[model samples]
Target chain A: MSHRSFVWLCLLPLAAVTVAFFLLPMARLVVTGAEGPQGLAGYLAILTEPRYRATLLNTVLLATATTIVTLIVATVAGMFLQRHRFPGRAILIAMLTFPLAFPGVVVGFMIILLAGRQGLIGDFSNRVLGEKLVFAYSIYGLFLGYLYFSIPRVILTIMAAVQKLDTGLEEAARSLGASPWAVQRDVVLPALAPAFVASGAIAFATAMGAFGTAFTLATNIDVLPMLIYTEFTLAANFSVSAALSVGLGIITWLILALARSFSGSAVAAAG
Target chain B: MSAQAGHGASVRIEACGKTFADGTRALEPATLEIARGETLVLLGPSGCGKTTMLRIIAGLELPDAGGRVLFDGKDMTAVPIERRNVGMVFQSYALFPNMSVSDNIGYGLKIRGVPEKERAARVAELVALTNISGLENRRIDQLSGGQRQRVALARAVAIRPGILLLDEPLTALDAALRDRLRGELNRLLRALGITTIYVTHDQSEAMELGDRVVVMQKGKIAQIGTPREIYFTPNSRFVAEFIGAANIVEAAIENGHLVLPGGRQPIDGDANISAAVAMIRPETIRVLAAESAPLSGVIDSVSFIGDRQRLVVSGVSNRSLTVDAPNTVRAKSGERIGLSISPDAVRLLPPER
Candidate 1:
């Protein structure tokens, strides 16, 4: 066989695996959600019912809140990691990105140990303030849990971006009568805007679609992911669960679309 | 754009030096001056601290000790770069890619709070001055190298700064573009008469662009003089060797006459020193046929350049010398030849340290 033909043959299995495992499943899910039983009515019901509607709204709100907080923390950490030379900086960076290697269940359990009612901060709060602090069982708890995974992704992405940025722009701005704040505002921030948008979109999508962490921490709260799980496994309502899955898929797709648009424009502007 | 406005901004450096935090002495204590409206080129090899001196003058770097920078008789040692009222063009041009040509040119004026209409008018004037009036609305990426260089020049001069600093501005261009822009640069700079400090390592560039040249060595000034003075009469052995291809022959002064090896004749210069190196330029060496020769040598090799041929001659003492002859002067390998140099063209430098 020719070299080019051999290369094409080598890629056939990987391409077939991707189509079978990913695209085919998604295509089947979409078809099932649209054609099964009550069909579009079932999807509409999930959007209109207050219980499910609140789940959607809460997902968006929590995701946005998580994105903002994660962005701030990650941006600061990323810039510090990129610029400053301090002791143990490599260790710090490793620790920041270490969460990505762990399963979501493990991260959720770690958060529980740190902030659950019987956990470290929860026990301290209860004994010190004479109240049981539900830090691991509330919506805020879910956010904190998702943060373990989201913040790291944001930091790694933004740090790579910051490292690759042309440092001359900042020097040029400073030489042109700009104070530190002015330089950050006029030069540094504008240069980092595209990376910020891209990482924020990823963080939002990850937080919204989080299932394992949400399921592990769903004690006093019922998030969209937990509700979808309960409809699938506990209530035995395949139609409702599929509809919820489709809804979550659409939200994630929207976020991915926004990310693509932002990244595209960023490249255009840089060019 | 009047020439009178750029005068009277003389810069004086007193014992300026820079030692980086890592203990590398980037620049040594050096004193110099740039008279009003004078174009000074800091010429040196890489890592010789010429760029460091330019940065110090631009206020981007602070000398470690024993230095004071004065502008127009005012001590500006503590002044920051932005407040120094000096303009700079970087080696990479550093034009804001996101900005149009007009906006890039108007940046400094805008930062200085020039009125909007005035900024516009001044940018228009500079665009025309740079011969880039039609490219005002183009982004930096859309412009060619020569065009970007013009934009960078226009941007540096838009504020009517008292001093202008250029860091290897033409090093990025091709030979043809560099030559063309250098001529234009000379005319424009002379017309504006800005107190300009151009930094470059290219000897030809320094000779062409500078009214005076400051040749620097490792963290110190080797010599400072006009192009003619530097080329024709270098102050030190390093200057002579660096500025051009020079034939340095070690000679001794015995009884008020120079003596060289291989039965070569003495060249006339000050005979004060007991021993020194005679610096002779390549063009000053004349080649003669062996029969009518004063000092005979074998032609080791010949290289035919476009206008002239370069011949490598080895004497009986194995002393090799390079001589430039007209392209019409042809010689075969291992052929006997005679080399002679004019006495007036020889300059003596102190023995190598």
Candidate 2:
């Protein structure tokens, strides 16, 4: 037939999949969110209710903190790894990115093995400081788990950006009387700003929606994903949990949209 | 502008050489001096130690132990590039993508703590000097290749450095643009009169811009002289062939004449040597009537270049000889032609390696 018709026919499968799996489910979630006893006000309860509001705030704060700390640690480590060559460098890089292969539950398990009661850190502190230090079940444990889950992706992105950097730019800066610190401040950091925004957005969204890590750590963590699970399965409060699901998805998507716009301007400025 | 001129310092590099960490010898130890307000060019093919020498002078690479670099008699071997007061134009131009054209030009001044008003005035002066006038606020990627080159030059010169090091600055542009910029850069360097060291493989650039050219080969300096001296009185076959197109003839000498397959050509050198190598430039060979000249050859091919036609004539020496005749001459392949040469034009070179 015609070329336009042929192209549309090729796209028919993708359209069918999107309607059946994505748009229909999203529409159902929105409708089911308003079907509770509180009616449409059940959606508002995610904010008006004191318990849901605290959980939402805790999740946002934890994700924000995780994103910031991951970007900092990844940028420094990636720059060092990209610039230097030594024995076992390839193995070291593989080991650094090994966490990407682990699921969230495994990350939570690893954090407990390092910082939980009867863990290595608790044992060391008990012997040295005369007090058993344990924090694996608190928000701090979840934060550590999220860091372990997010750092690998951010580090890979920052490393790729560092590799694309031109050595001549640094040399030119130094030739123009810029000190080492000044070169980094003016040239290197500005060139890598877009990478920071791009990878930081992924880390933030991942931390916001992560559930298994919180489940493995504790039941009282109060993160949005864990709260949604409790409301859906334990309390049998399906409408509130659906509303919270829609809220979490919208907030994550909104933050990512904001980050993409910021990165767009950053790329233009860098250019 | 004249007040800013003549601020160049004479540079002396004593036995400077570089051996990279991986044991690759990038440059052999060699000593050279550049006078104040003079432009010296290091001309060679790629991997010939030209860039390594320029880096040693720019403080980007350190020479091996026992080698020293001095600026106006002060030892500067320990000084870092940031404090060396040198301006460099890299092959990539290396303009800051995040900064405006004016900001790139004023970056060095800003680093030196120059006041905002003073930096702006200096930047504006450089903008006009480099003919990039109305592009002050434009970003680097917004400009064309030629504009980026101009901005790079202005940025390097805005600091009024004591020395300027350019490493193949115009090598990245198209041929037509490179020719135009080469002339402009020549004029700019003359006006500024800074002690400048340029590194390039383009001979025409070295001839037009350099006060003296250092021809390098295989991590060693092959020759160093004025462009005319290097062109006319090259000491080796490599220098002669590298500087321009030359016909190197290996022939036996008898009674001060070079024995050739086509004919015997007279030379000014001693006749005692059994065999010698001689160099003849293409343009120096004059085409003449086959019956009138002592040397003759049959034309193998003729290429009609705009100003001159190059004729590849076989049966002349051991190999075919290239002759650049005026474009007006009518010659074709398989035609018999005579070649005339002055005895003084034939340069006797040392035997090939």
Top candidate by lDDT: 2
lDDT of 1 by residue, A1-271 (tens): 9999999999999999999999998888777677657877888977788999998888888988998999999998899889998899999889889988877678788888888867888788888998867678678778888887888988987898899877756656555666777767766777788888888887887788778787777633667778878887888877788888989878777776777786675321100
Q: What local lDDT score does residue B306 receive in model 1, on the 0 to 100 scale?
A: 84
**Model 1 chain B lDDT-worst window of ten:** B1-10
Candidate 1, position B139, lDDT: 81
Candidate 1 Cα RMSD (Å)? 3.8
lDDT of 2 by residue, B1-353 (tens): 12234558889999998999999999999999988888999999999999999999999999999899999999999899999999999999999999999999999999999999999999999999999999999999999999999999999999999899999999999999999999999999998899999999999999999999999999999999999999999999889999989999999989999999999999985767989899999999999989999899999999999999999999999999999999999998999999999999899997666
Each model's total of backbone clashes: 0, 0
Per-residue lDDT of model 2, residues A1-271, tens digit only: 9999999999999999999999999999999999999999999999999999999999999999999999999999999999999999999999989988888889889989999997899999999999989999999999999988788889998999999999999999999999999999999999999999889988998899998889999998999999999999999999999999999999888888898898884321110
Q: List the residue pairs that clash in candidate 2.
A: none
For each candidate, what is the lDDT? Answer: 0.83, 0.93
| Global local distance difference test of model 2 | 0.93
Residue B295 Cα positional deviation in candidate 2, in Å, after optimal superposition: 2.8
Off by over 4 Å in 2: A1-6, A265-271, B1-6, B269-272, B328-335
Docking class of 1: acceptable
